[model samples]
Target: MTTPQDPENRPPQQPYTPPQQPYTPAPPPLSDSELAGYGQQRPAVPEPKEVRLSFFLWLAGAILLVVSSALVLTQRDAALEEARRAPATPGITVEQLESTVTAILVFLVIIGVVLAALMVFFAMKARAGRNWARIALTVLGAAVFLYHLIGFSLVGLVIVLVVAAAVVTLYLPASKAYFDSVKRAG
Candidate 1:
């Protein structure tokens, strides 16, 4: 015989409410020209022209080395013939002359191979968009220019140096962006 609670004093329980869904407003419609810009997105990074020039200089150097080596070999043979006919010098023997020629030829071959390898390495680095390669190339180009300018006074050296400088300058962030834009456009 328990007494019942009074309804007038009892409180009603509220129903559980789930979280509201996030409102994702519809995207604005794209216009034809504006939509095209999306497909024309630029690359994240671009290679510098200095990097390219450096590679080319390395290539030219290798080529010149080969040609010059050939010319030297021909001249060396002529000189060796002349020396053989001359009075036997006290300090020089045929064996020594032959050994010297062989050694020089071997050294030149080694130089050619090394230079070729360096050129390829730098070219690959430039293609891969390494900034340090650009710097390396600039230094290499400067070295070549100075070496040739002093010894040969060749205008090609001047041109290469000037181009190298220009490329380095033009590859600044703003210029790089411009280059990227042109690349994307094409």
Candidate 2:
């Protein structure tokens, strides 16, 4: 009966709430003008001269390998004669040595053709802006150069020098930029 059931004793009233926001649709796709503006911002890349030089060098190396194989085949008779004249080891006869020389020459010819084909394949891929191909060619070139250098013959030295030149060309600044651009574009 006192003070009309004390107002403070009543349950707390609910807090005021804001109305919910409606879901909005996404913006429309970019128009042609916007796309054109984006396209215009990127600078154009030029083809690197180093790439072309590398390709030509690889082609030359392949051709040289073919010619060298031909020369080796032509020298087979002389090689056989030389093998015959050499003093034979206790276990190996002159006939065996001659046959061995012939077999070695044939194996070398097959290797030369395979290597030439690989060189051409790598060169073509590198020309198409494949960074991996460029790297592969560089590594292969270095290996070839080292192998030929260790052989210590005039022809071997020539091959070593040519391979060195090709590797150097690939490392040029233009070639690096070309490879980088290709990677970015993809």
Candidate 3:
């Protein structure tokens, strides 16, 4: 029945005191040697086997692309023969037709080499646990698979299978964990 306003009825008050806690000073700023040591520390998380396999698969795809380009270049005679069989257009001479076909083949080979280089680059990055690189490689794999499927050749089917395998491996749980660990560490 006592109110705070009734000073005669109020209980004794104690001085405000902060809760006791062990004193912990902030860590000192790292020295140049310490910072260098941090850089030298081994990655706590080892890369998953799935990621390694995926990288190897991507490398294989790149190799395949290189081999296909070489094959195309070597088959110039066959391509020329096929071109010769086609009914000649009124204005285009045989030399012109051959030159045009040669140009197109060269351009295709160049594109193949460039794409192969990209695949190798992405594979290396993905191996280093770059999530963006993994995603990019996965998307590229899917695109390649779809393109090959649409084209429907024996070689295309082989490429589709390889890319599909690589994409699947890249998305495996172990691979995801490795990528997540890299993200956390960075």
> What's the number of clashes in each of the models?
0, 0, 0
**TM-score for each candidate, following the candidate numbering:** 0.44, 0.67, 0.70
lDDT of 3 at 70: 64
Better of 1 and 2 by lDDT: 2
- Candidate 1 vs candidate 3, TM-score winner: 3
Q: Once superposed on the true structure, which residue ranges of model 2 sit more than 4 Å away at CA?
A: 1-46, 81-87, 146-156
Candidate with top TM-score is 3
- For model 1, how does the per-residue alpha-carbon lDDT over 156-180 read when each residue is reduced to its tens digit? 4444555455446545675455445
Q: How do the residues 65-85 of candidate 2 rate in per-residue lDDT, one tens digit apiece? A: 777766678878987887778
State, as a TM-score between 0 and 1, how close model 3 is to the true structure.
0.70
Residue runs of model 3 more than 4 Å from their true location after superposition: 1-43, 146-153
Taking all chains together, the TM-score of candidate 1 against the true structure is 0.44
Q: What C-alpha lDDT does candidate 3 achieve relative to the native structure?
A: 0.80
Alpha carbon deviation, residue 82, candidate 1 (Å): 7.7
